[model samples]
Target: MFIYQKLRDSILKRQLAPGNQLVESVISDKLNVGRTPIRGAIRKLAEEGLVNVIPNRGAFVIQPTKEEIVQAYEIRMELEQLAARLAVPYMDETDYEHMQRLCDEEGETIQSSDFRAYLQVNKDFHMTYIRKCANMFLIEFAERMIDQTNIYLMLYEMVFFHTSPQTAPGAAEHRELIQIFRDRNEELAGMKVRSHIANAMKSLQIDNIQFSNLGDIF
Candidate 1:
């Protein structure tokens, strides 16, 4: 999984921007590994929807459209709202304590500006509620939508990084959501879940304009 990890980390760190060519030979030389592992890594990335492999052309990082990104968040808003509402009734005292610990960890990671740690804890924070949802189908479906949005954000987050301190506020929002859950205010918690998505979408967007740099969807 070395090649896979390298490619994923490169994309996450923005060393390889969206739509950057992932040539097998180039990767093999760059990573000083064999072509077999490089191809395997590319295949894995393609399977994960992080890269698109054209039949005749080589693999390139997947760059979803801004419209696609926004639409994904819209769907995520509904899914997360449902999750929050359902998760509140099932969660126990242990769950709340565990969530509180994660929120604390998230705050520390954000303060350190460890983007990777922040992203990891962010997923953990949502999945904590998502896993408690009554509906298995809803959980799986929500995860897929979240993954799609995350791929875009991971690669195209310079606009977000340059503007506000996005990570810290998001950690604070998780704490807010957790508190709402603790209060057993299902309806309000659901509203807050949707608001979280809305705020994330707005924060992700460029203030004045954004370039729709997406090329052909290979």
Candidate 2:
């Protein structure tokens, strides 16, 4: 479990660059763990879409293609729209307040140039209404898509740090979503969900981008 957490954090934080192989023996020596545990940890990461295990080859950090990211967001948009429709009836004052607080916190992260912190808050904002859906199957699938998008965002959205404040993403849209939810209009909520995700997906242009190799496959 410790190895899994370490490897997961490394991938999520971009400490382990995409397409880098999870070389068993090298990782074993570096983490002071054996090959068995490293293999186990890698399998876990692969299950989470953070790593790709290729048969006859080896495990590597997932280097998601632009098509993959866009497809994931398209699926996410449909699921989130459904989630918003179902979630609105269950949403209460506390959920609304929490979402607003997260939106505010996100703005602070932008000011401080704390991108990792912003990603966490952004995840919380979506999960706030998402959890209210009360459908475990939908919730699980939706969360997976969120995780994938977060990873994509982590790889791309860091560009915000060097750009103008006016160009910073999500905060305005989140505030708008918060109001839509407060209105308790499920139809409008679903429409907003579609636009919200579409806009986020549009911002990430991964075309022709190359990742630096961190390690080779054994």
Candidate 3:
């Protein structure tokens, strides 16, 4: 899990950008681990949709296409809306406070002009609430989808749009959604979640960009 998290973080932070060939030997040497563990970690990440494995070729980071982004965001929208609907009835004041703090932290990160930190915090904020939905299956499913979506955003979405400026609006939306949750308005929460996803899709336009899949790096 640690290795996978480290490698995934590197990819998400663009430290290991798309198309970078992942050499298992090199990674094992760097992390001072045996080939077996690194290989296992790679397989786990692949299952999480963070890496692509080609039969004879080596593994490589996924270079998301516009179409892939659209599909990811659409799926995220549906799943998140469902999560929010389920979460509302079970939400507590503590959860609300934690979400509020997350929003504030996100806002601060955005204002500080730290895009990487802001992105991490934004993800944290979403996960914090999404977990409260109390549906392990749904939470796990949404997490995987979100991870895939992040890969798309990190690799391709920023190429076409200025993602930094959108952070503030995204943070604001989180705040609004939290407020709706606090009010126990499941309907409004659902609507807000849908709107947030729609707005993100429109802003990112993952379906319009051109990308060529460099078939099976690994």
Candidate 4:
């Protein structure tokens, strides 16, 4: 489990990079484990859409298409908006403070050019609020969608406009979003979340020159 998490984290952080091949024997040797465990881990990642297993080509990181990226963000926009609406009445001071801390941490990561760390912290911050809705079904649904979208983001990040290396603006957006939540302004929160997703999609469309063919992957 630890090896799986470490490998997944490395992929998400881009430390492994897109299109990188994952050779089970090599990984087993490097991690000082048997091929059985490494193979199991790779299979798990493949199921999660993190790794692609070609019939004869071996395992590699999945590269997302432009359409897939757009679709993923669109789903995220809807789900997150719904989550914010559901969570507004349930949010307390503790949630607000924790969100603020997550924003600060994300800011630090972004400033340090640690995009992977920022992505993880950003997801954590969002999940923290979404979990407060206390609706298991909705929470699970939103989490899955976010997971898919994050994978898309990792795969096609360059397709979007250059993400700012600076953490201040991203942190500011997080802070503002939190303030909206604190005010119990569900409508504004939904709008902000939608806009944030839309901006991200727009950036990707303008920057990345490649378009993913959904049919090819499916």
Candidate 5:
């Protein structure tokens, strides 16, 4: 358990760092653990996409690339667009208040520059509606994909979008999304949600998504 936590946190915190080799003998020596559990933990990390285990060659940490980040955001945009439309009929005052609080908390976290906290609040904000949309299939599908894609999103934000989360298209954008939910304007809400998602990537200079002109990456 300790070895597992240590290795997982090292990847998340990037202590072990990306592309670094995870030599079991070295880890066993460093953490004073046996090879059995160390191997077990590496397999788990590999399953999560945090580490890529190569046969004969040892595990290496994931280095989230630009293409991977774009793919993840694309997947999220589709899920959230559907979720935005589905959540309208189900939303009540309680849901509104909860979402409002999350938006506010997200702003506060941005102000404080608590990156982890801001990310957590942001995920919570999205998941709140996602879980309430009452479509178990959509909910489960989003959860599974987001769980994997979120790691790449974190890498992108940390590496590329830095303090933007504190400024324009961050908290203000979140507030607008909340209002869209309040309006229960399903089509408009979906459009706005899609725009919000694309805009985030636009900041990174990746403006080549032609829905009509589909490509290989699709």
Candidate 6:
């Protein structure tokens, strides 16, 4: 898990640029771990849609396409809305407090222009409610979908936020949704989730701006 998290954090932090190849031996030597664990961690990342392991070529960080981003968000909207609706009945005061704290943290990130931090906090905020759905399979699937979108979010961080400084992804909508959750209005909560997803999708400016080559070393 430590190896996996190290690799994952590196990718998310843009330390390992998109399309950078993950060399097992280099990573194993640097981390002082065996090649077997490195290989396993890479496979785990591939399963999470963070890495692409080709048959002959090595695993590379994912560079999501415009179409792929759109499709992922579409699926995410449905999954998350359903999650919010199902979670309304299960949410407690503690969940609301945690989510609100995430929201506050998210606001701070925007002020600091730290979009990456905002992305992580945003994920936590959504997961707070999504986990309460009480459906293990749904939670797992939703988490994967969310993780996939987050990759795109990180990939296009500058283009998504800097180009339009006014667009703060879900900063306000998240707080509003928290209130909807507190109201225990399942349908309203679902609607707010749908709207939040749509707003976030609208903020993104998708293009063929490549960040790195797959031939690049990690």
Q: Return the top candidate by lDDT.
A: 2
**Least well predicted 10-residue stretch by lDDT in candidate 3:** 209-218
Off-target runs (Cα >4 Å) in candidate 5 are: 159-168, 202-218
Best-to-worst ranking by TM-score = 1, 2, 5, 4, 6, 3
Per-residue CA lDDT of candidate 2, range 1-218, in tens?
88888777776655777788878877776667678888888888888778899999999888887788889999999999999999999999999899989978888888888877887888899989999999999999998898889889876655556654455657888888889899999999999989988988877655524443343211
Clashing pairs in 6: none
Q: How do all models score by TM-score? A: 0.83, 0.79, 0.69, 0.73, 0.79, 0.72
lDDT of each: 0.76, 0.82, 0.73, 0.75, 0.71, 0.80
The residue-by-residue lDDT of candidate 4 on 176-207, one tens digit each, is 89999989998898888788778656644324
Residue clash pairs of candidate 5:
none
- Tens digit of per-residue lDDT, candidate 6, span 1-218: 88888888777656676777888877776777798888999999998788999889988888777787899999999999999999999999999999989878887787777877777888899899999999998899999888878778776555434532245556767888989999999999999999888777776554534443322324
Candidate 5, residue 177: Cα displacement in angstroms equals 0.8
Q: Tell me the lDDT of model 5 at 136.
A: 94
Model 5: per-residue Cα lDDT at residue 4 = 72
- Taking every candidate in turn, the Cα RMSD to the unseen true structure, in Å, is 4.8, 3.4, 5.6, 6.2, 8.3, 4.5
At residue 122, candidate 2 shows an lDDT of: 86
Number of clashes in every candidate structure? 0, 0, 6, 6, 0, 0
**Clashing residue pairs in candidate 2, if any?**
none
Model 6 misplacement above 4 A? 1-48, 163-169, 208-218
Residue-pair clash count for candidate 2: 0
Q: Give the per-residue Cα lDDT of candidate 1 at 50.
A: 86
- How well does candidate 5 score on lDDT at residue 128? 82
